[model samples]
Target chain A: MKYTEEHEWLRIEGDSVVVGITEHAAEQLGDVVFVELPEIEAVVAKGDEVCVIESVKAASDILAPVDGEITEVNEALTDNPGLVNEDPQGDAWFFKMKLDDLSVLDDLMTEDEYKDFLG
Target chain B: MSDTLRRTPLYDLHTELGGKIVPFAGYAMPVQYPMGVMGEHTHTRSHAGLFDVSHMGQVILRGPDAALALERLVPVDVAGLAEGRQRYAMFTNDKGGILDDLMVANRGDHLFLVVNAACKAADIAHMRAHLPELEVREITDRALLALQGPGAEAALNALLPGVADMRFMDVATFDWQGHALWVSRSGYTGEDGYEISVPDAQATAFARALLAQPDVAPIGLGARDSLRLEAGLCLYGHDITEMTSPVMAGLQWAIQKARRAGGAREGGFPGAERILQELADGPLAIRVGLRPEGRAPMREGTVLWDAPEGGRNLGGVTSGGFGPSIGAPIAMGYIPTTSAQPGTRLWGEVRGKRLPVTVCDLPFRPSTYKR
Candidate 1:
């Protein structure tokens, strides 16, 4: 139930947070054809651009959720670009980042708040 | 930015993806996504791609003698067009200028017309105004998706079945989950694929299913442009228009011989006199393909020169880009017929730099047609 103003979503998973583009963003992009992931161990800060997500008509940069270092990249979408368009929330996540500021989550919108913001 | 964009069922989808939407022929369409244009262009050529072309007009022409009447408007041999088959044709002004480019398909009893989204209204209005005796119906609610790439046929065949049987330029009807769809083996991208017309209700689902295929991916307008550019197909407003005759645009093959008969030929269409005259003699200016010496993309309005070193300015570029399939920059333009020969060297002024260019065949890419 976490969100970045950029429309990325995160779910707390004990030591890490699973992140991906929100349903709203996915629906807006029409069909996401490809997701470019950042390299593992890549360092980043809050509001920093790290990755990219491409759709049928356009490509979107994946803004960092919080200051962190990328630990894992989603290799699944390399060959199958449509993975992001099919499941932006569940399977289309570009990568995982190790938080530099663990509580940067405080600034992000919750699922309900983001939904309301969209409304 | 203008509120004039006619939305498709996928409008909301484009907005959420951070699509940089722009007005195109009255539709709010994405020009390029955040990845910029080059990546989007490359992705579509090597892999499968999807496109939302719902803004294009789908029309139905019906009347007692619709086929015979339509033949008068276009040069393609309409009588030979079998049911379920489609052919590209143009509406020429009496003076021979191209009014519009459209696809005329025989959907059993009547003719189904698919016109460019931007020119549809004028095209329809022109039809109703001139052929008052004929019936023209606009099917505005349907949405169109173009699935193009080397893998399109296989991906679609796995989902829709029977659709693979359609060869290049052929068509077939399939029932996807309950909605009837018209799928054709024609596309703007120089790939083996199809352009599908589906009811709005089923368009998204159809797109989803196609995307689910292992090879299918969603492509945007950006890639679509590069693909078409490499293929050397003309875009209506940029390549041909009512002010430009078919002969000048290098579309003489579209005029059927029977339609070319005296009194019935070119001038009878639009600017038929100019078109017929251009055919009898050669056009003063004609569309030609251009190959630049460098990789920079030459764009519309770039001045053309007849000599490599400041030869007299002969014409200008109309559409140009880094063609994905061609693996290089390509351009199209109207140049003097005297300089239209392949290998004829020309110069394109890009950003004040006169880039050396060569006149090539109309299609920079070898057109792979099932015919």
Candidate 2:
């Protein structure tokens, strides 16, 4: 598992990485009311804003962690946005992306480094 | 938080209740508590919620000419208001724009005014400069608290015996344990509620006693805003601005018949020409309630268009948010009178994409005021 400074967490799957917001980010956002997901098979570069998360208070954007094509998105969030607040890192994973080189994840922060960064 | 920011008398109590303090209107006020904005909003709809509104300015206008002098500034019947009743009013600019919205209560020999926190300093200056015959004294030694919801009367009446007898928009002075509490049966949430003005020394204890009841919870500004939005209320700096006239903002009802074109006290306020003309011929642009089609919330500053693809650009949204009680996204914005029909279709441009939105009536939810 790897983390980005923007409070996104990425976990390596078979040939793709699952991206979702961290628990810390979800807590800061309070209650999640709506989520606008990126379309499947959409090509995106690193740092590209692909998703939008709306809370009761404000709206936030989710950026593509690394260069990849979106493979699948969590359709469950469309019916129930509260999943992002309930299980932000687990069942609430936003989308899965196929990266050309999985080794790029090595440059991102680890669990220990992310915890220290939060401090 | 900056050191220059002011603190309300309930600041210590809010911190003690785990409130998340944030800067609002030059004050370090609580935006939400541990209950969160959604929970607090829903709770306020179902039960009583207490809000520390001490940041708002409270002023008293004395002398025999106070009511008549105040009538010159606002387009309302201040002189005709009864002794124990309060009326909603606004300070209009020379260009027919709204300076600020306020509540004026006829407190026997004096008129009690409650203005917005951000506009209080300028409002006091404006009142002093215009109504020189009246003594304008700002009450800085008291704190204002709003207890709003369907359960508000029961909760407040448990502590203060006679609050249940006061009807909506009624104002009275009650004695609670030797404290002269100035209370009004009015609130911004469109619910049966009371706005209690207590001395600073007794505010914390009074709030604590109210919170002791099961139906009362300490709400914050986040819920206060969402509640007012659902009630079709205009926010000070947003919906009603220095550029939006009363008729344009759909606040013509606040202007009584006595202040109209052919009435007894007509044409004395600032910008009376434009306001009276708009009242007769109708405003060019008017404010309307809007509901988005999907779950995505169309927030403030989202531009409106006449068509989805290519059309004329209308005005932007003034106040927009996800209404917890209504269980959907709601908004209010200005648009052309031709397109202000209740069921008219419009498009709100959110993040470069035009989404479907329907023009609805003023309030998204029905007001449950105890009339």
Top-scoring candidate (DockQ): 2
Expressed as tens digits, the lDDT of each residue in B1-371 for candidate 1 is 76755778977767766667878777788776655455665666666777889988999898877877887777666767788888889988766677789998888878888999878888899889877888899997789998887777788888888887788778778888888898889888777778999998887777778878887656567777777877888898888987778878888887767556463333345555676677789899989899886655577788998766745989889898666556566889998888899998888886566878988996877655555
iRMSD, per candidate, in listed order: 9.3, 0.6
| Candidate 2: residue pairs that collide | none
Q: Where in model 2 is the C-alpha error above 4 Å?
A: none
**DockQ of candidate 1 compared with the true complex:** 0.05
lDDT of 1 at B99: 75
- The stretch of ten residues in a row with the least summed lDDT in candidate 2 chain A is A98-107
Each candidate's fnat = 0.05, 1.00
- lDDT score of residue B294 within candidate 1: 63
Per-structure clash totals for the candidates: 31, 0
Quick one: best TM-score, which candidate?
2
How would you encode candidate 2's per-residue C-alpha lDDT over B35-73 as one tens digit per residue? 999999999999999999999999999987789999999
Model 1: TM-score for chain B: 0.93
TM-scores, chain B, all models = 0.93, 0.99
* Chain A alone, TM-score per model: 0.92, 0.98
Candidate lDDT (C-alpha), each: 0.77, 0.95
